[model samples]
Target: MADNHLGEFLRARRAALRPDEVGMVAYGVRRVAGLRREEVAVLAGVNADYYARLEQGRERRPSAQVLDALGRALRLDADAQAHLHRLAGTAPALPLGHTTDRVSPALRRLLDGHPGSPAYVVNRTLDVLAANALAETLHSPFEELDNLARMTFLDPAGRLFYTRWNWTAQAVVGHLREAAGHDPDSPRLGELVRTLSAHSADFTRLWNTHTVRGKTQEAKHFLHPDVGPLTLTYLALDVRDSPGQQLVVYQADPTGPDAEALTLLGALTRSAAL
Candidate 1:
């Protein structure tokens, strides 16, 4: 899967451009699709053998400088560049495929207390391990039992939540692929890859792109049944007790109706408990 991802990504990027677009003229009869190995190596300022190794997945880790050069040569956008860094093993990241730690009563209390914020915990497979009232209410589709990637790709309502569903969907799928890289031995991760590959072509395409993303600022768009579509920034917080287990939090703009809605949601949860 990793080899397929890297090869396909390079191939797609190469095909997306006409050689003339990158100032490489169609000099002669080219047999294969996209730039040849040597062409990309020349553009990226690396030896053909080295680039070949990288493309073949022989090279697991490459320097940032080398990756940057490749990014520039390929004219990769920001997300694509980050993906390249991840493939090169340059991102400061958590060990994936490790779903550890019980949600301690204390941790559960914290999520419960943050009633206004859409908060939840994710396992390595990006499964919704647990969620609070606001999270359930806001991400209504995810309230059902499904992994994040599955919901992102397989569910229409889940897919509908994102304003740029295509981009967000790609990222979610890529993140799952990255998890696979971090821990190749995981049976559950393997099963997920198999399921997604069989299920969603979009996921299969993005997965083959060999993209990687660290928890950067992600503003999610959700079409809540009651409050309508909302945009909220997301943060992934690591639980202290569990090294790789992360607590994801969602927050809206300070003065927006979403903020007000969150407050109301919290109150409703409180009233229900009372």
Candidate 2:
């Protein structure tokens, strides 16, 4: 029998893909993205009816061979492929509570070691599990905010912090959507959503968009109260043996106000400790 959460995950992934992007053409009117039932079936070398049944949540269990074929057909990367397996119930399900990754000592050292760079450690949910002095100084905490998603959605300060507020908020929601697939039953995640949705209408709006994105290198702009607007590039590196932990590092853009602001933020951090 198909589980509700499993069906939701499959539906979310199905919607994330598009026809043109997946090398498929409807040749007529279509109601959905990516390959249609027939197209996906053809690509996966399976019967159309079987694929339809699988999509409809009538077939919950698929063999590893079938999942592998479907993954290729979908052009899924390793993380996305794992998400597909979890959705199909081939992988063991986890509790959707607020399961979090512990900040490793080495990771803490890594963040502290990068005193000049704005560095923080985040779990799959984009929770700011910890931050070094530089990151803490750069982004103001709102209502005692530490979580990235919370700040992006709930904090007025964070709204001011993000130069492009709308886009930044949407990106956080999109990132959370991607993380949800990695672990659906985590109560901690459920609580986080409940808190933000209750407080921020914007969060609720973006969450409904159903967008998803993997953690990758990207640029961010922040309007710091102390130093003005600063742009930075960020990248997340996966932590070994930690399924959800990733260390995110941010560096100032070499040109423009970001460079000046970064130097100022660094000085602010050093002076504060003096």
Candidate 3:
């Protein structure tokens, strides 16, 4: 519902950092959360009023240098820095409908080859465009599997499916925020955000944080109804031909219990499909 998302992001990031983390001494009882607006301005080597204006949406377009400085001051990682640039209107926008939900045949072949692992493809907006049998089995417990963001927040089973629900929720929201920055005018994305914001308070809270991050390599813990508890490492690979599509593969250590469970689950899935 809020339109000044860039400002909201800046404000949230500023509120997340503490004075001590930025090498500033805290002498008095702080009245505000995280670093004050003045503190961020000082750390980034910018005027306080100017930074204030940036957060207030009065200054929509910030120079690249300022954005870089702000990124540094906030201790943002590479993805977050890129996201900051996008929010500040310094990054190039994706052409409307740049991302397609259609999965390529080559990608499908790749997914088919990875029978031992759960492999799926998602677009910028976290839409599950394509999935292998293992991947489908992996997410079979969910009522809806089309959109990862929606399932992560809106579904009642999401909390149980993701062992670390809070972390996954935050990561999903951050990824969506990053996507929004690149494709600001996406109708589907706008609709998804509005829908999630209205349905889930937790989604709304995390969304308000404006954190941005790409889905990279991570260890994910899942409590699959069929597989029991499993821990798998996932890799997110960009589909070079499809600009905004990512091929994600999840695999458990070959000698581990999770791998055995996954094998059993695969067999079960095959039987069910037949």
Lowest-sum lDDT 10-residue window in model 3: 93-102
Q: With candidate 3 superimposed using the best TM-score fit, by how many Å does residue 151's alpha carbon deviate from the native? A: 1.4
* Local accuracy by lDDT, each model: 0.73, 0.75, 0.88
lDDT of 3 by residue, 114-221 (tens): 787899999888999999998888898899679999889888889999999999999999899889888766788899999999999999988877788888778999
- Candidate 3 ranges beyond 4 A from true positions: 27-31
Best to worst by lDDT, what's the order? 3, 2, 1
Query: Candidate 3 versus the native: TM-score?
Result: 0.92
Task: Tell me the tens digit of each residue's lDDT in model 1 across 1-274.
Answer: 4444555566666655567766887777788656777887889899999988877777757789988988888878776776666555686656543347467788789888877788898865787778887777666655474478888887777766776788788778766755654554567778888888898898887776555555667787767665666778889887876755678999989888878766766666666667
RMSD of 2: 3.9
Which residue pairs clash within candidate 1? Answer: 83-212
For model 2, residues 124-172, the per-residue Cα lDDT tens digits are: 7777888999988887546654688987777668777787888888778
TM-score of each: 0.77, 0.77, 0.92
Q: Whole-model lDDT, candidate 3? A: 0.88
Which scores greater on lDDT, model 1 or model 2?
2
